[model samples]
Target: MKLLVLMSLVYLLGSTEALKVLVLFPYAVKSLSILGTGAVRHLLNAGHEVTYITVYPLKDPPTKNFRQIDISKNAELFKNDDSLTIGYVLEHQVQRTDPLQIQLVTQESARLTFENENVKKLIEDPNEHFDVVIVDLVETETFAGLAVLYDCPMIWLYSMGAHWQPLRLIDRATNPAYDPDYLSPAKNPLSFLERVDELWTRIKWQYRKTFIIQPEERKIYEDTFGPLLEKRGRTLPDYEEVIFNASLIFGNEHDAVRDRPSTPQNFKFIGGLHVEEPVKPLPKEFQDLIDNSKHGVIYFSMGSFLQSNSLPKPLVAELLRMFGGLKQTVIWKFETDLPDVPKNVHIVHWAPQQSILAHPNVRTFITHGGLLSSIEAVHFGMPIIGVPVFFDQFTNIKKAVENGYALTVPLSHNLPKDLKAAIDVMLKDDTYRKKAKELSSIYHDRLTKPGVKFTHWVEHVVRTRGARHLRSPAWRVPLYQRLYLDLIALVLASVYLFFYIVSRLFKKTPKKTDKKKRN
Candidate 1:
């Protein structure tokens, strides 16, 4: 009888502590989905019941607590989309600062996610319930409706560094005077013109988001989630309210590698959480190649999204010619084979990037400036030469340059020469390596591993029932009040009224004097 009571008590406690978490990362970008995967894995390992909605599902067999809703079909949209390729972007001179194009693209992706048969089935299931909903912090605002439907706390996962878009959702907007927009090419300590440009860029984005993007997203939100709400006899809340009601935001950022902004309590930085520890060993061939390098090795990759084969033929030839002349071994992540390859250069269709970076013989990394790559380079104490393609890549590289561990070479006719020059500097300069190591030390100096911290906060939010106390008061404050625009208008109006009164008094005094002279 005593044994039966003890066993029952243990089972009840375990059941009470295990939360049902729904993680939605329906974005087709593999790089972005990796962050979501890291968070989900941690949740699963923590004994939580997780139902992950992903474009890339885990290859391993599922456990009892883990359920995957694969939406890999959505990734087909990007597989053949040349416009998203770096070559197309460079050739067409796409203005990444303009949010219209990307906003539309992400909205389309959200629509696809909502329409996914698996996602729909999950939504329609009457018995489905979640204690918390974790979602990607891109333009997937419509997915926030799930939290509303399930009546669970929503946690946003940001795959990039802290930016105004996600920040404004949980806290106040960042100052544009010094903090450049994520998509803007401008760097900090901006010149007068740069400041004006930054301010205008933000204003334009906000205007477009308010007048254009929001309405479209609202419609999509309603169209997708309306029936579910109707079935429950509940009307949908305002789109903005639903999206902004997130309990917390976990940003892939660290002060050691990137600038730390004034973030609220609800905002947490868990950069490098995706970097698996005890990195897998390199293949024997790669290991031997790195170990036998005379001078050192330069590892070059354009990340998962951009393909090296997409580069213009002339540029590819130029890169090859540059690599041939270099004394250091060059390992390039190229998608397709090239003719007349250099003996010193090695090409791999796919690479174990972290393993390669962890090798001591790797002197420098030539990269696409993706946040993950940048953070990984910092993690392994490798200096970088960034060739930023678009979007936040530019910002990530700019921050690295400002931090003294990296240099940027723009994509153009002079890229080969400029890249060679930067490579030469990175190889010869001990200062860059020293700075990288220093940043690495700081990055590793955290009290807890990022994954542990991430899981703890997530469980904390669940335990505390959304941890509402950590939410910023700024979310409750009106936009006009937050900006103090009303106060400024009141002061300006008072000054204008005072000046008008004085002008009238002077005119009346002059009229009286003229009348007295006539008398």
Candidate 2:
């Protein structure tokens, strides 16, 4: 009888711990979607039932508790927009350093996601309920409508290092003085001009968000979620307030990769959550190439979004010429076949990037400096030569350069010479290699794997019913108070009043001040 009672208790505890999670990652970007899927997979591993809304679906065998709502049709929106492509940006000489531009794109993506037939059905169904909602935090405020509809705690999964935008929602915004904007190329310990530029960039972004993006997002939010709230006899909350209602933020950052910034208890760092553990062995072809390399090997890739085939012919020729002279074998991730390839250079249409980086025979990485690529390089103890294209790529590269394990070559007229120089320096110098190894050691020294930590915190939030106690008090403070602007204004007013009193008293005794002149 006692044994039966114990078994029954265990079953009850297990059943109670299992949560119903709703994950919405409607963005079409593969890299961004990967982060969301990582969290979803972890949640599933922890025995939670997940309803995943994504443009990319996991290929794993179907699980009993996992249900995916495909929004792959959203990818068509990106297919029609070429402005974000590296080829278009390069040919048009477009600078994608504006945060507002990226936000605008995200806003549009959120609108389309709501309009998705499956997504509309899910939100419209009153039966659709979840214990918690996890959404991608890439300027995706409109998705918060689901959280409101379900009346569940929302968690933001930030795909990059701590940025001011998302931080402001959960806690105080990071200072622009030391922390550069993610879109800016400026590094930490910023120069005077860089600080000025950073502040101006932030101001512009805030202005645009308040005036342009938020208004449009509010309309979309009300149109989608307003009816649901009305049916429940609940009035819609302020859009700004709804977006700020998240209980926790999971940022993809690690102190080993970047300097640790001040974060609230509610904000968790779970960088490298997507990195596979005990990395899979390389395919035989790649293994043989790495093993047979005479001196060493250099791996080159422009990430998923930027295709190497889009590079100009002259630049391609220049890269080929440079690779031909090098004793080190070059493995380039190109999308299409190129004519007159060098004997030393091998081209693969697709690459197992992490697998290649893990190889000891690979010396240096030539990359477009996406955050994931940079973190992978540091994780594998491999030095990199960054050729940043757009968005946070420049900032990621700048951070890498400052960290001593990477060098950057601009995509300009001097790119050929600069690329060759960077590669040669990275190959010949052992300092870069040493620094990379040091960082890798730090990255691997964590007590718990990022995936496990991510799962624990997420479960903690659900178990604690939003963990509201972990939230920062700064969120309750007004912006003016947080900035100490109100204090500054009071002090200024006091000084002005003191001066005014002193001036009036002096005027009453004015005759004494000019005594010498009167005599």
Candidate 3:
């Protein structure tokens, strides 16, 4: 099998010598924990020594081969609130994303985490060295300090899709008209109004980012790392310098999922790294339930970040009642128990999602439209009914609906009825499953899986100092040259002068002609 061969390659190639690698990702989200591990696991398995910094590492045992520095305090960014529910997520992450509080939280979280004692101890050590550094590329660029301090090449591992900001770090951003903002509700082939909205909003967003955000972020970088850099006789390299030098930007997106033209050479998609070919098996008890399903099985979950228990009690009860009445056996991942559940309905605090989806009897997935969930659904050749809540969920569900393999119900509508109706449509129509299989074939058609691509690429960046050829020339171009603003201004001025001179000549000659005619 290709996976076996890939593992052999890693073993043979990795055993030659050990590489020292440092990976930095301090975000508290559980999904990010998985992503960071995906990037470094190959290196760890291949006999390399790794120093990892993260918020919540899924693996706890420390080995001489691997050292982990926990910065779990970043979890404070998501405050505990009794009122936090799906509706709350819909309001902020979906309706609009530019809340000032969110901005402040991310900026401050990055500053605090990067300045933590554990982080400082590692960076300040005179003996500590690494061949390469990898940092999570989020809204904050200050974490690039690890690369600067170590005097090594950096690979930015972006956990989600490529957005305008990160894309701009590599090359000129894709045209907003065609690509749109990552959060935009509109797809490509926009109406006139949509085009105007995208262009105008993009222009304003850029202006604000350039004038306001970059300066503030730069200040934070200097304020936090100034002392550390000063010791090495170096000031903080500007944000542009930090990101533009990346060997490659690992995007958690699939080529088949995107409709755009060729992207920058440095932008590589390695999505589905989390999916397993032979998915992990479910527990015996859960397996029996799936095997005994008379009709079929519908799997439902809201992912790690959102809790199904957070929904209003009445709504939750109603959904439960409806599912109990249905012929299909229902598997709902709920954090708490219900008093009187139907015999056909099973509830659990945690469910093995991939194994469930892989089972032949499992029919469809109900999800919050998170990128990772959507990707897994497509990978398993299973259709989905998306309950879109927030952030990129809007975009993910829209694509699913457009692809004809899924339907969506917004949280703003009647949650129980909408969800029920969407499920019925998926179960009744064989077309959804057929289309899903088509998409799955496209997703699996790649020469190698995402995991292999990641292992090879990570090693490649380590062996070569950034593989600089991968970087685009646009990275080095000055603003005026790239836009040709000065050249356009000069041409406009020349045209104006020519017209003025011609008009003056005509006026003077016309007066003479009029006088001659009068005589």
Alpha-carbon local distance difference test for all models? 0.87, 0.85, 0.79
Candidate 1: RMSD over Cα atoms?
4.4
Return the candidate ranking by lDDT, descending: 1, 2, 3
Please identify which of the two predictions, 1 or 2, would achieve the higher lDDT against the true structure: 1
> What value does the lDDT take at residue 248 in candidate 1?
90
Off by over 4 Å in 3: 1-16, 59-64, 81-84, 87-94, 99-102, 496-519
Error of 3 at 479 (Å): 3.0
lDDT of 1 by residue, 394-468 (tens): 888888888889999987767899999998888888999999998899989989999889988998898888999
lDDT of 3 at 88: 60
Locate the minimum summed-lDDT window of 10 residues in model 3.
Answer: 510-519
* Angstrom error at residue 18, model 2: 2.0
TM-score of each: 0.90, 0.90, 0.90
**1-519, model 2: which lDDT tens digit per residue?**
999999999999766478899988888888887777778778887888999999997777356899999898878877867777666777777655667767877888888888889888888787889999999888758888888888888999888888788888888888899877777767777789989988988888888888888899999998888888898889999888998889999888886856556889998889888788878899999999999998999999998877777777888888899889999999999999988999999999988899999999999999998878888898899999998889888878887888899998877756778888888888889999999999899988999999889888888888888899999998899879878999999999999999999998877643545445654
lDDT of 1: 0.87
Q: List the residue pairs that clash in candidate 3.
A: 93-391
For candidate 1, give the lDDT of residue 164.
80
- Give candidate 2's root-mean-square deviation (CA, Å): 4.6
Q: Model 2, poorest ten-residue lDDT window?
A: 510-519
Model 2 has an lDDT value of 0.85
lDDT tens readout by residue for model 3, 1-519: 999999999988666467888988877667777677766676676678888888886555546688888888778767684333584664444464562344555677787786789877887776888988888776666777677778887788887676676788788777777777666789868988998988887887777667767688787777766777798788777766775666778888886685654568888888887776568888998899999998999999988777877776777788888898789999999999987888888999998888998898999988988888888888888899988766577788888888889988878536778788888788889999999989989998999989888767777776777778778888788889989999999999999999999998877543434445553
